[model samples]
Target: MTERLTYYLLRGLFGLLARLPWVFVHGLCHVFAFLIGRIVGYRRAVIRANLSRSFPEKSLEELRQIERGFYLQFAYNFISTPKLLHQSPERITSEHFIMPDLTPLEEAAKSYDCVLLALGHYGNWELFSTGQLLLSTIGYSMDQVYRPLKNKALDRLFAEQRQRFGARLVAKDKIARHIVEYVRAQDGRHWLVAMITDQAPGIGHATYFTDFLHQPTAVLDGIERLGRKYHLPIFYFDIERRSPIQFVGRYVPLYDPKEGDLPNYTITERYARLMEANIQRDPAAWLWSHKRWKRPLEHYPNAVRSARLQALLDSAKDN
Candidate 1:
C-alpha cells in the first residue's frame, strides 16, 4: 500500500539521480548541503558548540571551516548513498576502494568463533557492507548490526539495499541469540560482527568517560563486554578517504579473550583512541550533527570516569 508505494517512489527517484553524471550529482549535493545546513540552524549551532568544546585549542575560524566541510561531506554522503544502492560489486571495488592488511583478522577468525569489529561514523560506512560482501566472496560471513530507522518504509529500503550484496543485516535489538548461533554454526568460515562504536549508548548503559579531543565523552562498554563473554576476537576498522572516490581500510587487533585476565577497558580505549585519531585526520568525515552527549552527567554521573572532565566543564562556566 502507501508504504510500499512510497518506497518504490523513493527508489525510482534515487535510480534516476544515480544515472546522472558524477559532476552533476556532486553539484546537487553541494547545493543541498548549503540549503540544509542553513535551514537547520539549531543543529548547526549545536554542532559548532560541540566542535568548539571538543577542540578548545582550535580558533573560531578553524572550527567554522571544519563545520562547513562536515556539511559538504554529509551532503556528498547522502548523494553517494543512492548511487551505491544501484552500484555493482565490480564498480565499487574498481573505484579506488583498497583494503590493506586483513591477514591478522583472517588468521584470528579461524580460531575465535566470533569477531567484534569496531567501526565508526567516519568515511562512507555504506561501503562497509559492500566491503563485507567482498570479504564473503573470499569466504567470510559478515553480519552487520544496525539500529533500525524509525520510519518502517525507510528501514525496509535500507535493509534491501544492504542485503543486495549477500551480507546478513541483523537489527541491534534482535542480535544476541542470532550472533551466538551464527558464530557456533559457522566454525571454519570467518564471521564478522560489525558495529559502529562511536555512538553514545542509551541512558543507564555502562560507559567509560574518555578524553576525546578536550571534551569528556562517554564510550560504550558493550563491545568489550560482548567480546569477553563470547570469547570473540576484537578488531578496529580504520577507514581513510583518499579521494572523492577512494577509501583505504586498516585493521588493528585489540586483544585475545582466551588469555588469562584480558583488560576489557584497554581494548575499548584502544578502539576509541583509533577513532579519535581518524577524526583528527579528517574532521569532516565523522558525523558531527549527532547529539552525542545528550544525556547530562548529572543524570548519569556513574558513567563519568575522568575527574579531569568535570573540572574542565566547571572551568568553562567560570570563564
Candidate 2:
C-alpha cells in the first residue's frame, strides 16, 4: 500500500512537471543547478578532484568553469527526465532528440541477431531512450541493461519511464539469462543491447584496468565478454548535445567478428578511447561526480593489464 501510494505521488509530480513549458523547465533546472553546485556544493570535492585530474593541463579557472557546467548538466539531466515523462514521441524525435543516421546500425542489425552498443554517463542519457523508435524502424529493439535501484518504488518509477517507449529493460544480473532465453525463443526480432560502460566497477569485479582520463581506470568486461561469446557486432553510441534540450546520436562501428579475430580487451580499449575523446570534446557533459578512480589497482587481485598499458604505466612511474 505504501509503495503504491509513493509511486502514484511521484508519478503525479512528474506529470505536473511535464505539463510545464520547456522555458520554465529550463529555468527550474538552472535554479536547481545553482542550489546544488553553489549553495549545497553537493559532491563538490569529488567533482573537483575528478575534473582536476582528468585535465591536469587546464588552469584552476578553466576547471572551475567545467565544474559549474557539470552541475548544470547534471541538474538538467535529472530534472528534464521528469519533464519528458509525458512528452510526445513525435516532439521528442523531431525537436529534442535527433538520430541522424540509422544506416550503420540498420546494416549491422540485418547481418547479426543482435548488436552490442557501449555508452557512457555522458549527456542526458535518459533522453536516449527516445531512440527506441529509431531502432524499431530498423527492425531492432533497444534493450538497455541497468542496475536496479534499491528502493522498490523509485525503481518501479524509473522502470516505467525508461520503458515508456517500446524499449525493453534488462536487469544487469539477468542479462545473460535474458539473452539466452531471447535466442532460444527463436523470435525473428533482433535486439540492440545498450550497456552504459563508464561506471567504475566494484572491487574484485574490476577485471580490466586501462588508461582513461589520465587515470588508471577500471572498466567492466561484461560487454566485451558477451559480444565475443555471441559474435555480435559492437558499436560505440556517441551522444552530442546540440542545446540544453536537444541532442544528436551517432553510431561508430567498433568491431565485427565476421571481419577477423579480435585481440583480447580490444573492444573495451577502443570504447574507452572513444569515450575519452568524446569527453575531451565536451568536458562538462561527462559525469564528473562519479568516484571513477576511487578504487586502487591493488584492491582488485584478479585485474588484468595489457602489456602496452603496463609499459605506459611504467614510463609514467619512472618519469
Candidate 3:
C-alpha cells in the first residue's frame, strides 16, 4: 500500500513536470543537477574514477571538466524522461527528437529479416521510444531490451513511460527467448531489437574483453551472439544533443560477420570501438556515473585475458 501511494505521488509529480514548457523543464533540470551534485551526490565518486581511468592521459583539471559536464548531462536525461511521459507523439518529435537521415536505419530494416541496434546511454535516448515515426513507417516494430530497476514502483513507472509510444519492452535476461516468441507471433513482420548495452556485465558474465576508453574493459556478448544466431543486421546509434532540449540521432551500420571463422566477438569489439569513438567525440554525453568496471581484471582468477588486462590496468592506474 505504501509503495502504491508513493508510486502515485511520484507519477502525479512527474505528470505535472511533463506539462511544463520545455524551457521550464530544462530549468528544473538544473535544479536536479544541484540536487544530484550537492545533495544526492549520486555516484560522483564513481564518475570520477571512471573518467580518470578512461582517460589516463588527461590531467585532473580536464577530468574534472568532463565530470561537471556529465552531471548536467545526467540531469537533463533525468528530467527529460518525465518530460516525455505526458507528451504526445507529435509534441515529442517536434520538440525533443530530430533524426536527419533515417535512410540508414530504414535501409537496414529492409535489407535484413530482423534488425538489431545497440546504443550507449547518450543524450536523451529515451526520446528514441516516443519519437519513432521513421521507424514505424519502415514497417519495423520496436522491441527494446532493458534491465529492470530494483524498485518495483519506479520500475513500473519507467516501463510505462517507455511503452507510451508503443515500444515492446522485454527484460534483459529474457530478451533472447522473448525475441524468438515475438517474431513467431509477428508471422512475418520484422522487428527491431534495440538495447542500451554499455553497462559492465556482472562478475564472470562479461565474455568479451577489449580496450575501450583507454582501459581493458569487459563487454557483454549478447548482441553479437544474437546477431549471428538470427543472421540479423546490426547498427549503432550516436545520439547527440543539437540544442537546448533538442537532440539528433546518427546511425552507423556495424560489422556483420561471415559464416566462416574469424576473430572471436568481432561484432562486439566493433560496437565497443564505435561506442568508444562516440564517447571521445563528446566525453560529457555518455554515461559516466555507472561503475563500468565492477569486476575489473583483478577479479577473474586463472584467466588468460585477465592477466593481460591486469597489466594494462596497472599501467593506466599508475599514470
Question: How does each model score on TM-score?
Answer: 0.91, 0.95, 0.89
Best model number under TM-score: 2
Query: In order, how many clashes per candidate?
Result: 0, 0, 0
User: What's the lDDT for residue 227 in model 1?
Assistant: 82
Regarding TM-score, does 1 or 3 come out ahead?
1
Off by over 4 Å in 2: 184-186
What overall lDDT goes with each candidate model? Answer: 0.77, 0.85, 0.76
Residue pairs in collision within model 2: none
- Candidate 2 lDDT over 174-279, as tens digits, reads 8888777666665678888899999988756788888787777888878888888877788998888877678888999988988677778888898889999999
lDDT digits (tens) for residues 271-308 of candidate 1? 77888898999887888898887766566666646555
**Residue-level lDDT for 246 in candidate 2:** 81
Better of 2 and 3 by TM-score: 2
Candidate numbers sorted by TM-score from highest down: 2, 1, 3
Could you tell me the lDDT of residue 200 within candidate 3?
87
Cα distance off (Å), candidate 1, residue 259: 4.0
Candidate 1 lDDT trough over 10 residues, lowest sum? 301-310
